[model samples]
Target: MAQGNIGGLAGGMGRFTELRQRLLFVLGALIVYRIGCYVPVPGVNPDAMIAMMQAQGGGIVDMFNMFSGGALHRFSIFALNVMPYISASIVIQLGVHIFPALKALQKEGESGRRKITQYSRLGAVLLAVVQGGSIATALQNQVAPGGMPVVYAPGLGFVITAIVALTAGTIFLMWVGEQVTERGIGNGVSLIIFSGIVAGLPGAVLHTFELFRDGSISAISMILIALVVAAFTLLVVFVERGQRRITVNYARRQGGRNAYMNQTSFLPLKLNMAGVIPPIFASSILAFPATLSMWSGQAAGATWLQRVANALAPGEPLHMIVFAAMIIGFAFFYTALVFNSQETAENLKKSGALIPGIRPGRATADYVDGVLTRLTAAGSLYLVAVCLLPEIMRTQLGTSFYFGGTSLLIVVVVVMDFIAQVQAHLMSHQYESLLKKANLKGSSRGGLSRG
Candidate 1:
């Protein structure tokens, strides 16, 4: 499927310099990001960090390392990745609906959007600072099983340096992502995360092989795991492409011989309009508290913080329940934010179109909202099942199984979105080529007529 998209785009590349440049720019940006992943921060012992991660073994840490393209394991500058930015964006988005001033700003147009974006950026920076500091403090107390400290020189100087390095790395990534969105292809942040996950695939496969060799998992279990992943991938693709189309009919304008014909179109409402955002948001929010608790619990030996961290650990009942609920809630919340039923109804009314058997104003909004609510509920349920099932399976398997449902969902959705964008560019190129040919033909015919 990916090959087909690339082939189609390449077929038309000769006539589309802009698309070619955009693709190249995206490639270059991703390469730059991958390079940054290996650049270690100062004052940290990368070897010790790796040893600590291996000694602790797989679970949340492994998942985070995968997301960071192994930067977390190495304690590289990009260890935070774009998670702080994502968390900050979620807070800002929620604020827009809750605060009157923000809601008004949202209503305001381009300038309002710029203000909101600025706010999100600032929030990201703040979150990055706090998270980076927590990581620095946590590292101070962390020691590998071999008795080597994760940090070479643990002091205020080291803490300050680590915080500065991490925050700078995150800020750089945010800039790269924004540039990609404006000058390249797909979503910058999502693509960054996608690249990290893709880069980790080889390592994950190798680790699984090691496990098999060590007799941690049977061949039959491995086969079953592969089949399950394949099945889930198919399920994700099907559901992501699923949509509910509402038939909209334009009112006839005239009743004479030259009367205008009524036109019919369908409004496509996606099953998961929120895409992979809900899970990302839920993960970010949940991880924030866990990180803080772990930091405090380890540094100060606080019993309460330890209990909180334990309860929120992945695969715990409370963790699973909260995670599922948050996924469903964010699914609804993000869907509402992205697709406003009232706005759609107003647009349709202005264009003299109405849903079949529905009134043209508020009633239309109500009907559309009803349909969307049902679809979102189903979609949210699907998301919860996809995200939680892997955790449950991992618990039962008693082994670290890479490519959990969240990772799989993210991989599939990002690829789908990227391919769709490539196809769009290809279509646009073809349309322009046809227009140019028509213009040339018309000019030639005029010259012949004059002769």
Candidate 2:
């Protein structure tokens, strides 16, 4: 048994080698992204920026920096990362539901998607400019622990330079993500975010250890945190992989001159159909107010804005409550967008497939929708627990834990997706090889018969 397992693993590894070019492309793109993280925006003092971030004491800054792969710490060109793109995507997706023209375009299929993507790119550029300008202007007012200005030349010239540089960087990163998705591995944008979060793991681990060494966090507390993380990771893996298989039966149908017998299959509905998207969307939305308050000197002084920012800060009850709500909301919203019950029912009906006892058409759509609603409700609750529990525990425990629930979820989900894609590619290659071998054998047999 052990030898067979080892032999199977060896064959799998050999098949993985067939995808070397794609793997290399993904690696090279990530390397370029990492390099960009170190290349600071022109005129910003990297040391002063780091000092300011350190002094700010890790709230929204830490969150953004985590997503940026530490680029925000250095005020690098990639500091904005894929955030603007994500926000733009959310906006476009929402618009698809609200606007008639957009809804019509959505039904137009591939060409429509391309147009929507183009719009998203345009929105990303626009958002990047606004955010970059905000960051640039904010840097002019920011002072490090030693009263050092983050921006040496804080003026219109600096703002323009920074804006242009940051916007260009976002566009370039967007292109890289698209390229990776088309030619390389799994979803490119997710991989980029995954690389960023994974990049920060080493430093986060070292920092946690330093805190423990310095007696900032107790040994018992450390152990508890580890246990919580492990439990949550296992829960996420199991739930993410879990699916409700709705069995569908297909009646006999005639195709061409042949009459086909009834068949059975399953329509798999994932427990968490939204995957990591809800948390990402929730985090991005929740961070917006805090980002405004954190960056704007004017907004910081306003009592109302300050109150709002404080209320929404991580670990705050309001923050957790709102975050949970948003996660659940986006989960259902995104899931609905991705899986249309009415459309699915129509397709199934046209294909003469129906759930075990459910009628075809309207009844099937209702039944599927009802099942999905329950699953999404449960899935959303699972996401809320996974995303908020660790933060709540860490806040209560008073540990300087770096990785948040959102980061962990993204890492795990992306890794699973990447592995699944790799396996799929390998299987496809093996199948093609088998077909070619069979064809070659048939050709040889035909040649011998002719001889």
Candidate 3:
């Protein structure tokens, strides 16, 4: 897909140059983020922190670390990544439907969007503080089980500094993400997460190879893993691209004597309308209890918290049930929020279009809604199957099963989007060159006529 995007650039160095500049801009920004992933916050021992992560980051911590590009494992300033911002945005987005004031602001156009963004920023800052404070408090008790300290200096002073630094880091990353979206290529936050996951690919590959060689993973199992991953990727691409097209016909209109012909179009509804939002939301919410229990002074409540965390840990039956339910629920909820059949029916009715057999207004809306509900059901089931199967395998098979469906989903979708963006830039560049040549030719023809 990426190759196809850049293939037409052979005709003009200018387009290539422009594409290169955009790619370079994105690359440089990612480089900065990657560098920040290594810069540890004050009062934490980087080596010790990594060791602790190896010991404990098998669930929520690991998931967050992937999103942060391994910053969480490093206990770096960027440990929180843009999660605070993402969670904030999701909260505000959900609020739009729940709150009348937010709903009004949503319909206010570009100005409204800016206001919502500002609100999200504020929310992100607050979340950063809360999450950062949690990390600091958690660090106060972070021991390697064998008595090695993860935090070299742990106190109120350290906590305050850590919170401030962590919040600042998240804010900076938010700014970087904005810049990447405005000036570079693809979604910045997603790309950052993608970079982190892909960055670990080499090490994971080597580790798996080593395991296979050492008889830890048998030849048949290795072959099966590869085949399953390939099949899963194909399934994801197929479903992600799959769409249900509802045909609509527009009434003919006579403008200047001759009757105009009727026009036809189709409204495309994706199979997976909810996308990655459901799983991510589910994971974040489910991880909260464990995150809450990380406080150092929660010793009085430690036993209960530990039991709760254990029950909710990855591969646990309760965790699987809750996770699946949430994914399915959010799938429908977010799908409804995004694609309102009533709104669509109203817009089509206003525009003099009708879905062939369906009556206008209520009937059309009902038809659309019913179809959407069915699609969401199928999509949610797919989500549960794809996400849970991998985790189930990991629980039974072992911890080396790192490339879960969630990671694959993010990787596939983001890569496709990134390639699409690159293609857009390339197409735009080609058009610009064509316009310039046409303008020059017109000028030359005019000069010749004058002469």
Q: What 10-residue stretch in candidate 2 is worst by lDDT?
A: 1-10
List clashing residue pairs in candidate 1.
none
Residue 82 in model 1: shift from native, Å?
1.8
lDDT tens digits by residue: candidate 1, 1-451: 4744564465466647788799999999999999999998898888898888776653355667788889988989999999888878878887887788998998899999999999999998999899889878888988887889888889999999989999999999999999999998799999999999889888778988899999988898788878878888999999999999999998776787777778999999999888778887787677765556544545556777667767777888998999999999999988987788998999999998988888899999999999999999999999998988888878866655677767889899899999998888778788876676667668878999999
Better of 1 and 2 by lDDT: 2
The sequence of per-residue lDDT tens digits that candidate 3 reaches over residues 278-323 is 9998987888777655543347757887778778988899999999
Give the winner by TM-score.
Answer: 3
- All candidates' lDDT scores? 0.85, 0.87, 0.86
Local accuracy of candidate 2 as per-residue lDDT tens digits, 1-451 = 4744565566556677758878999999999999999999999999999998877744467777898999999999999999899889988987887788998998999999999999999999999999999888888889888889898998999999999999999999999999999889899998999999999888878888989999988999889878887888789899989999999988786675577788889999999998878987788778777766666646546767767878988889899999999999999998888788998999998988889888888999999999999999999999899888878777776876666878988888898899999989988877766665567668878999999
**RMSD for each model, in Å, please?**
4.7, 4.1, 4.0
Q: How does candidate 2 fare on TM-score?
A: 0.90
Give the Å shift of residue 399 in candidate 1.
5.5
Question: Which has the higher TM-score value, candidate number 2 or candidate number 3?
Answer: 3
TM-score of each: 0.88, 0.90, 0.92
Error of 3 at 306 (Å): 2.9
The best candidate in terms of lDDT = 2
